[model samples]
Target chain A: MSERVSRTTFYKRLSRLWRNGDSRPLLMQALVVLVVLLLVVWVINNTMNNLEHRGISTGFDFLSQEAGFGIIQTLVEYDESHSYGRTFTVGVLNTLLVSSLGIAFATVLGFLVGIARLSANWLLARAASVFIETFRNIPLLLQIFFWYFAVLAALPHPRRSLAFGDMIFLNLRGLYLPQPVIEQGLMPVLASVVVAIVTALVVRATIRQHRLRTGQGTIAMPWLLLGVLVGMPALVWHFSGATLSVELPQLRGFNFRGGITIIPELGALLLALTIYTAAFIAEVVRAGIESVPKGQKEAAAALGLKPGKVMTLVVIPQAMKVIIPPLTNQYLNLAKNSSLATAIGYPDLVSVFAGTTLNQTGQAVEVIAMTMAVYLTISLSVSLLMNIYNRRVALIER
Target chain B: MSDQMIPARKPPKQSVGLLVWSKNNLFASLPSTVATVLIVYGLYLLLPPVVQWGLLDATWWGSDGTACTTEGACWAFVTARLDQFIYGFYPQDHQWRANVFFFQLVLLIGWLTIKATPGKKWVLGYALLLMPLVSWWLLYGGLGLKIVATHQWGGLMLTLLLALCGMVASLPFGILLALGRRSNMPVIRALSTAYIEMWRGVPLITVLFMASVMLPLFVPEQVVFDKLLRALIGIVMFQAAYMAEVVRGGLQAIPKGQFEAFGSLGLSYWQGMVLIILPQAMKLVIPGVVNTFIALFKDTSLVLVIGLFDLLAIVQAGLNDPAWLGFAVEGYLFAGFVFWAFCYGMSKYSQRLEQQLHQGR
Candidate 1:
């Protein structure tokens, strides 16, 4: 193996590797690599020179330094005394909170509107199209401003909030909801809830196996599920003796206190992100549904399935194969758009970490790189999961 | 029986009459009926108030917000600052230059978008070469014209410029990236894939932040970029990743046979891509390309984060003025409407183009 080939044979092997001398892709690739390496080095050298020129020390050490700034909508335990690392965690949590909430609401609303657009009823379909067109065309930033400054800011102050049966209140400050308080012994209840879920899943899987193997439906399946899912949790709560109370926010001095508050920054960001993204999701869903052949629906109907059953069983499963890829894209988009929360002081990753921390520390390279890395991880991970799903569902050819 | 003359008597009342149509469509079932009623009620609540606020009670001629206030939108504010929103601080005398450039662009776009227009080759050359020169001369005003600095350009003018430049500049680079991603060379392929993914993974805001703040550090100390140019660079780089994907879709749809055919015709890879493969692939991807352009156009609003006063930022600037402090709603609505109109119009054209191309294929 260590022996070298003869010169004539070596040249012959090289000619074969070069694809009969058509062109030199290897040469081209080498050139590209050299250019890229040179570019990266030049950039680094210039950056070092500039950093020295500006007297700005750069490192990730700034992340451990005192943040000394406050974020209005932190999800984690945080204060002015926390480190920039904690601020980063808080910003990530807030971004995830808004993104997950937006995803949930947009999925529900988008599906409904998508179905409405397909409805036989002319009015509903027209209304759905109008909803899509109006929201889809407007810039999200403008919509964010409209919701934050125009609508929410115009609400009355805490002293004269629009009370909702006195259990909820809307004011310029934010939406105040009744907070559910559970004091002591909640661990048992939570454990029972998890147990109930596990038991339900086990029962379902067993029933499905029995039916598949023995070819018989379990008549008491619904009752068994209900008993496990509902009865178990209720019994655990009774035995645990946990006390629960609902506390409505009350006006304290000039501001409201003691309830779960959804600040207007979050409200506006969530609303804009949800509404804007839902429009795209609606289009994706509509296209997905339309992609299902009409013959499938007709064939299912001919087999005596009702329209609803036909849709649920036959159309939806097929439509999902079309929907998941674009739906994943929209999810990625919403996550990225959550950064727009910076516009309204929503304390997202970009706003708190990149905007505020970078300003204070003047570690532009580190701060911005960290921010981009977080988003990149999110987008790449989601797309990777979607790729696996796509591969699983892709049509297999002979 | 064969003639079936009885069928011609009249279609059943269940299918033919207006009442039947309404019953079938508007009151088809319980949920639909409820939806119809709720929707009508919603329209009743929303439409009249919207019309009344927008038109009936709006103050259209006032010079300031304090003039002739009513319980409706102050269109007067928009009208008073309309020129500012359109021209920004571009010198009042030099405003005609901006107008001429806009008209030239409008003509170019119409020529490109209209179906089967003649002189396509000439239009391509003009768009590729001449228009950029004319625009720079007309807007930047250095050739026998008074120089208008970039900061003086803002509002809708800057918005269009950013979108157009981003679209034009990224397109060829996007094509190259797409080709490189599909290249047989492993190193080039890996590098292109990494470059595309790196941009696509991050949000545009981060890209803009890096461009505006950290970009100067990556260049020599003597070099400086105007804020608008930095923002444009960010937009182009961010947009190219998406554009590459679209073009890749087009390229992928071209079968391997075409590549083999080009090769058999004694064409090198670059020659084949440029002379044969690209034209056909580009035709397939027009609508997809247009869709990305709409995205880039809407994304132009993001420049405001970097302190560039594009259309939305101009409105924001106006709203910040002491005289117009309370008209955030009016300012945002106007800016929203303008953005919506452009986006909606482009999207509709793209959709129609897709249908037309699909039918042709």
Candidate 2:
């Protein structure tokens, strides 16, 4: 009788398991997990065997070995005697330099073009449209080629460099500008600049709070902030005995000898990234501006707000909601597109670590994995930062 | 009273015509006038030279590089290498195969574009399933035809082939991924999410590198993948992740009531999805799909990094040739123009499709 009862209970439990919603999905998931695991295991096994047969070690020990190649451009001190790890860092820094510069230039250009596209003047609008269409339609790689092979390469040699005043030169090699030499007292100037920025932020916050509480606006904050930021730095530099010296680029054998030089590869990559991304950003900016309802502008004007105040308080704030998302995307794309510097031998992460290092070490898997991880980390961090900003700008409704 | 009406006076001078229009639009404020004058001056300084260089002084036709002696654009170089630019090193005599394939492609695309095409389902099936095979056979040459190595395929032909194949191959995978991501099963969703995010997060260059270098290690020792095939696989994988996100957006737009309606009919999950859900969802996201295609089209140039002689690569190669020295400008301009034309055309078409679909809905 006890055995019969146990059998009945077992059957009931089995039926319940089969009939439950959660159990079905759990079973299906388990099967899927098993299949995926099997595939991964097979691939790993194959990779191990292949590596063994090919006599290529699968670890990342080669990163510590010397890199015997010279990079044309580097943000940090690097030489052939440096390790592959140093090469990787140089590549990452170069990429960051180009991408950051590209972002800054593109944002300015994009905003200009975007506003011009909506200009009251027909000629201005048409010109902006033409610019957008021309840049947007062409592939970025081709544009890079245009700048590198055609434009920069076609420039005359250093002996015949194009001079802008006494301090700047452009030639086949690169743009050369006078390098600034800061003297001992420059720390005071730098400190004052930092202090000015913090003071500006505090002042702006106070003004915002005062306006919110009293419904009265103070317009002096921006001018005051600008004065503190620029005036204080200038005063410190002038009176604190901080001597600024310029080291002009001297023409040497075949190239300029001493000064800051922007290599053609970096120049071309920056130009292409800026122009191409600016075209897309212009569209985003245009769309965002257009997305703001006409009523918002009218309502602000009806409230007796000044033209600038109407734009700042009503139109731009609303437009930010639409613009921030797409703007973030463009910034991310600029970062990713900077990888194309590889094609032009720009010594970017992909070119240095993935291309040269991998070729030297024959550690394809490890090199590629590392390069990919760097990009993934950059992408994730950018998105996280942008998401926080987006949340603040997002419309709040009760 | 009509007879006594005063003769119609000329409209107040500043109320109409060019003067008023300019005043109202261009010179309305100090800033506006400044912007107008600056832009006009910039255009005046820029436009004439570009026109002269691009049109008036440009060389049109020549047999070789000598015909392009002038400083202006050497269209002659473009003319000299036009065939190579279109067909790459695709054999001189077998170029007809590519021509025929392109012709077939045009017809298929034309048919697909027509709103009232008869037997739409069957036509779509034929175009999607059979056309790729036939085109592949023709282009690659197998079974009774002379086989053309994929390495020989370059230029515009290679570009189109990569873009089309990537788009076609990615669609199914992307759809499945999108579905899996939205599935109730935890493991499938996690896997799909991981795959999609990883692909989307990294640049396509790294992906291509992995495919070119590391893929061989992942497969068995005996297995071989052609260079083009490996690049294509990488592109397909990378694009599919983006396509999945786009498809997921479409899926989310579908109302829950549609699922309920399917359930009311006692339809299975797959049946409901295949028949009702996906059709509506895909229809909604046609513009997104086309945009992805445009992006893929542009991205095919990256294959050059993997040593594929695509159109841009061919241009670079031509520039390197001693015969075509100092003609990088013309070659690059030509390549850029071609890419621009194709991308711009596709974008306009997508915009039109979006408008039409919006109206239909």
Candidate 3:
């Protein structure tokens, strides 16, 4: 009985020490929590009071109202008579359009510039360096403004437009190019094209299998090209009396007619976004390519690969592992920066939905919420896609 | 022993002349030589026009476009509007107040950044708390000098003020948020996460729009903040999110051993952070912080969208002036050069800091 009582006393002392041992840190933590909660509460109270005093109803019911703005270069059909929701759809599509074009052009230019920077030719390397430094240092918005207000705006009017070909022209008004119209029996031609692609893949797989079974193989590229390229066109021509034709842009009074027109606004925005972002992308690409060791090329050369083959087969594949993450970052930045197009009155996502629709509906909360949600989704998805790509290319070790 | 056997060193070879250097570097092969010539020609075609238009044929001394109707660039628009570009519509007589405030700010920043500030910690505290108050008095001038309203402030002055104030306010808030993100308590972490994600997910333009239009509705009726101040707050809040992310990166880079060491020494978490974690983390991330500052400086141009006449906005305004019609190129080029200089200088300085950190390591 005495031993049991001693054990209980020991347990009681241990509990007492544990309670007060970490008390000070816990108290400081509690104080922090208290301050945060109190501040939040105060702000919310103030906001509600402010809203009530201003008589502004803070709800999101206005999204269904008619939006009175038109967006340029929308992927989907849209009209000013549509609801704000539809306008937002158009805006998002336009944003995606510019961003995708910017990404594609910037990637190609960036790779070329990056390679040129590492060139053996002295003048070419210096030129690339000058390009990178000059473009990257300037503000992107200023470049956009310069292109819009200075360069593109100074082009000759439609009557005196610069002609590229019988079918194409460049002018202050817009770029005019022939638009393709689907002829009868086009679906069968498209089906044949798809079939050709599938057959090429099958042939490629069979070749791979044969090479593995017996260490002898033949080049499949010529056959694959013939199947996909020549086969489809031939089939299309035979099946549908479908003939390719160009509708030349003709000047009618003040404007050009008889072709699809790309406005100067879109042209300026695309040019500025591509050129400005390409400078940054070029740097990222250069860093990524440089991060791959010279020994990689040496190894490929030592294995009897030609220089061009070594670059394509060995050097680039490794460099891509380094290139993709920062490339995704540049793409995201381009998408975000496209919002600056609103400054130039380009009917982009921000201008259509955020500027005009917000003004009409006065649903500041809902409109802003939608706008932010779209960008966030774009940024998040691009990052997510890159993460997947990164995992695919990442080095695997035991 | 060494004199018995020695390796002979030959004189440098004849394959080291300028011609050889040119061959190796520029004309390593036939294709490279062609590439060099083509690039030189391209530069030749591009550079001369720019030089002629921007320098040789440029009009430097004039106040209007009529004085520069020659076959040259009329740069007079920029010069004529230089005052508006720098000080906006701030009353001309009281421009000295803004100048004084800017001077004091520079001094304060210099004092804080230097190594030999007497009583370093307390002086820094004073600098942090006092500079803003003194500058405010100098700017607002309610106590003594003539009062200049916020709306009258524009151009580079407004841009600098907004950025400086935003940075000053955001730093402490950013630190707190960063600490909260790493806090042991679930509530604190969640709160910080929500705060950071909310601000970060939205673009700065939308935030500015909210501050200008929606914020008024959130405050009590008739309790109006200056439009510029509202924009300033938006900038601070948005920047704080980015700053928090940067600080969090720095915090994550700190080794766990440092934390454990402090804990082993019977230090509280706050004590550990103040004494051990921050100094090391900050040193590791100085370059990143400066890059953020550069980005923030560029982003200040967005205020133009909200109808504030910043440097870019003033230039845009100048472009539309009837007297300066068709001179948008000159105006934009001037603005671009200014922005380029500022950003490039900061980026170079950051690079230097990065080099110093490498040396330290």
Top-DockQ candidate index: 1
lDDT by residue (tens digit), candidate 3, B34-117 = 898887788799889988988899887786778896777887888888888888898888888778877876776567556577
Regions of model 2 farther than 4 Å from truth: A1-20, A216-220, A395-398, B1-27, B115-117
lDDT of model number 1 = 0.90
Candidate 1 CAPRI-style tier: high
Fraction of native Cα-Cα interface contacts (under 8 Å, chains A and B) also present in model 2: 0.89
- How does residue A258 of candidate 2 score in lDDT? 79
Better of 2 and 3 by DockQ: 2
lDDT digits (tens) for residues A1-398 of candidate 1: 43455777888877786775545677567778899999999999999999988899977887788999888987778999999999889989999999999999999999989988999999999999989999999888889989998899999988999999988999999999999887677878888999999999988998988888898996247788988899998998997787778888998898889889999999999999999999999999999999999999999999999988898889999899899899989999999999989988999999999999889989899888889999999998988898888787874411
Top candidate when judged by TM-score against the true structure: 1
Question: What order do you get sorting by lDDT, best first?
Answer: 2, 1, 3
Candidates ranked by TM-score:
1, 2, 3
lDDT of 3 by residue, A1-398 (tens): 99999999998876665467566446556777899778778767777787666566667666677776666666787777878788887888888888889889999998899888888788888888878878887778788899999999999988889998677899998899987766665667777777877877887888878877886975356666676666776867696776655577788888888878888888999999999888888888889878989998898999999998898788887788788888888888888888998988777778888899888766676777788888888766776788787776664511
Give the true-structure RMSD of model 2: 3.1
- What value does DockQ give for candidate 2? 0.77
Ranking by DockQ: 1, 2, 3
Inter-residue clash pairs, candidate 2: none
